[model samples]
Target: MESSFSYKQTVPSEWVDYNGHMNDAEYNRAFSLATDAFIDHIGLDAKGREQYQYTIFTLETHTCYLKEMHEGKEFEVVARVFDYDAKRIHLFLTMYNADGEVVSTLEEMLMGMDQDEGRPAPFPDLVAEKVEAEYKVNAGEDTPKQVGRTIGIRRK
Candidate 1:
């Protein structure tokens, strides 16, 4: 559980939407970049994929846009790992503007995969141990509601 990882990016012209703000797809791109950074921090990288045939596949995601972002604006993304199990990881990411205001938030759940077989697989012992250690350190640091929140309307 890294407290945070930072990434810098400039809004791309192609990412602009009809609303004149960064499009929804761009949010996913930023989140994906942040996820890669976190994975690299935990000893997983492209090289590891070739050697271990392990990778992560996103299972689900929820994002909230709180403010508008325009093309050519510089932004930063921060990511945190809030929870994980033998095969799954829960992550939270925040995008911020140069003024330090949050522009969006993304929540995602991912599962480990056997790249060779393209199937869900349990995390290796060494990788699981590292993730567990980080989970312990970051767990309970944030309220349960924040950690477990989902977007959209709830059905009765």
Candidate 2:
């Protein structure tokens, strides 16, 4: 198993939808926040952005909602760096309940951005080293089923 980063969060009442479960957008929001935390952990926080003019932008994301979560519920996200290079990162985040049952999964590709040029750029050497280390630590684990899933109708 991979050594994943954990981010704990509480479901807010405002995130509930008409059916009383957390809205679809909220799931993405939670994942986004977790992604921010991961970025900060990898030394890409506000200070790093200011110093190196570098940051991260989500290139794409695929989220699978496995179980409905209600308002006031406590959840945690476990994040892993599945892969990364000089300019991109492939990550997987799983949201789990207090009991450790998975509630959602998100697979994402993120690009490192150069703020001054407002375009993709390779990470600075220090940041690249950290990202590579994270990827190496996580890539050796058993792959989760949600990774690389495509959305389509499958015939029985």
Candidate 3:
């Protein structure tokens, strides 16, 4: 129910590319950081993962660059659990600039995995409950219009 403000950072100079904007890969890096924080919030934190040998693996990702971001820009990511089941989570995140303009969006599919067996696994009971509760809290959220879009040009 609370706003899920998970990650924040200033765009580093090293992230800028020849065109003078943050590089494509750097967006991914930012998203990854936000995702880590979200999972930890839901109880699959680093210490628990190491103790249980369980973790979430990103199965797929889609990113939409809605606006260009430059070095020195401060930004933050807000995440929502969108949907989930016992073994998988469908997640979405939006990156916003300091002035609150939308900069980018990311959709990701992640699967819980058992490191010992190297296979998919259901989330631990507590984690599953937390995820479902978070999903319910986010149920009123309008799915971002950019979600589920494929990269292609409209033919004239």
Candidate 4:
């Protein structure tokens, strides 16, 4: 969560809840938008996906809220490539407040899907190269605490 983020967003009125802060669902929406931006960064925007007949699909996500975000407040997100293979990827996205503090985190598992075949598929060569670049860029950084968390109830 300490790495610098490249994507930023300002909280909107619609995202505010009766509690006078951004709602839980709105946090997910923001993260989803960031994910789309990451897809574009990897050169798999709509047009590129069409050419490759492939796209990344979110298979699972775990979110952890660490701080409050009010409407009109600016936030940032950095998507780090936690791990990946030919067909699957685990991404760690950290959300930060204007003061550069961790506000939230989302760890998502994604899969490459072949639209033409309607099944799981390997990332195309170009995309694979990009992903490896991402991995290499973040490999030296420490893994966030929220990564790979399992939900459960503690026994006393």
Better of 1 and 3 by lDDT: 3
Model 2: per-residue lDDT, tens digit, 76-107? 99888878778999999999998889899999
Q: Which regions of candidate 4 are displaced past 4 Å?
A: 1-5
Q: lDDT for every model?
A: 0.79, 0.91, 0.89, 0.90
Tens digits of lDDT, candidate 1, 11-113: 9999999999999888888888888887776656887666778988888888878889999999988776677888898877778899988888888898999
**TM-score for each candidate, following the candidate numbering:** 0.82, 0.94, 0.93, 0.95
Sort by TM-score, best first.
4, 2, 3, 1
Give the per-residue lDDT digits (tens) of candidate 3, residues 40-135.
Answer: 988889887987789999999999988999999999898888889999999988899998998999999999999999999999888889889878
- Which one is best on lDDT? 2
Instruction: Assess candidate 2 and give its TM-score to the true structure.
Output: 0.94
Candidate 1 weakest ten by summed lDDT: 142-151
Model 3 residue pairs with clashes:
none
Candidate 2 C-alpha error for residue 137, in Å: 2.3
Position 81, candidate 1: lDDT: 69
Please tell me which predicted candidate would have the highest TM-score against the true structure: 4
Better TM-score candidate (3, 4): 4
Candidate 2 ranges beyond 4 A from true positions: none
